[model samples]
Target: MSEKVANTFDGRLIFLMLSILLNVFFNALTVSTNMGSAVWTASAVNLAHLFNLSLGNTLFLEGVIVAIVNLILLGQFDYFRLFRNLIFIVPYSYLLAWFKQLFFAMGIPFLPIGWRFVLDLVGLTGVAVAVSLYQRANVVLHPNDDLPFILRFRFLHGSPCWSQWDSNIPPIAIIVVTAILTHQLFAVNIGTILNFVMQGYIIGWADQHIFPQLHHHLDFKSTLH
Candidate 1:
């Protein structure tokens, strides 16, 4: 390949690697938090297993159901494009469950239910910070991030100021509604609202700090010219 083409390919690979590392690092931190929301995702997998659903199938179904609801509420489907990000989420979910199982296997005492809930709060905050930083990078966002952008662009019709905070609403709403419905259907609440609040602040902070730095680093203004 030509030098330019080679560089383009290299850039894509670097972005993908960066994405995976960021996800894995945050996920590890989240698991360490031993939070309710983090544990809840593991519980979902366990429940699916009890019913004979393979891990892959369960993740796919969950994504599909959530994506559908998001599309319905936002009255737009562009968020479907974000499914590409699921390429990472599926594997990451399984790894998280495996990590939980490993802890059990190692005879690590489980946290009390109350402590787990507190951990959930911490984990949610961690997620918010991680996602906000990732978004500010303006690199390829996770599937979850893409949903909010799609909704903002489609529903707000480009009118809303496209800061990070304004862009996060759609994804946060989707998670909240999904958690509610999932609770109703399965009799298990996942505490998505709290997750949104914690993560939302992280996003806001990232927009304020990380995005500007990335813009300056990229010389984005020069690219526009």
Candidate 2:
């Protein structure tokens, strides 16, 4: 690549990698707060419980499955993308384990139920921003989000009778309903509801405002293609 092209490529790589790390970091923080509901976390929780496996292992397995599906659907599963997902997902799972252990070791002391609920909302804000940044980075998305994107790509992006709103419903319904069912297997909380309802607006706002400004600031004019 030309020097200028290489610079842009390096910058995009930095941005995408940083975004993924932040997503995992903030996700850990949200889970530590004992009030938040994330679909992936809930899914991990259920999976771990079902198989009596560690949450970290469950996350890794889920990531593996999701990565393959994403690659197949996007038809861009070159070695680089596969390797990229591999390195990112593997450490991400282990880091999750470490963070959760640290938090628990610090003593997840009792908070009032009300306080826990508030923390969930506070943590949700972090979760929203992290997810928004990662989505805008246009990198390999977490499986949890990628599935929804694939659904929209397949169903909503093409159908004439279905408007954006109509296309929007199914993916949201699929993930959220799956979360609810999984949580019911072992959890019930308003935090999950908050995650379900608030995400669309957050993502919309980020795409319109945060993403454009960020891309402009970074001068990100290229994709990884």
Instruction: Give lDDT tens digits, candidate 1, residues 167-196.
Output: 445444444465555552221234444543
Best by TM-score: 2
Residue-pair clashes per prediction, in order, are 3, 0
lDDT tens digits by residue: candidate 2, 1-225: 343532354654665677666666656655666665565665565667667898789888878876787678766765655555666677778787677677557654265677666766766666666655655554555655555555554646622222223423433444455556555443225665676666656655665665344442211234544
C-alpha TM-score for every candidate: 0.54, 0.71
Instruction: Evaluate all candidate structures by whole-model CA lDDT and list the values in order.
Output: 0.47, 0.58
Over 4 Å off, model 1: 1-35, 38-56, 64-83, 106-109, 112-118, 137-141, 156-191, 210-212, 215-225
lDDT of 2: 0.58
What RMSD does model 2 have? 5.8
Q: Which candidate number has the best lDDT?
A: 2
* Cand. 1 TM to true fold: 0.54
Q: Per-residue error at 88 for model 1, in Å?
A: 3.0
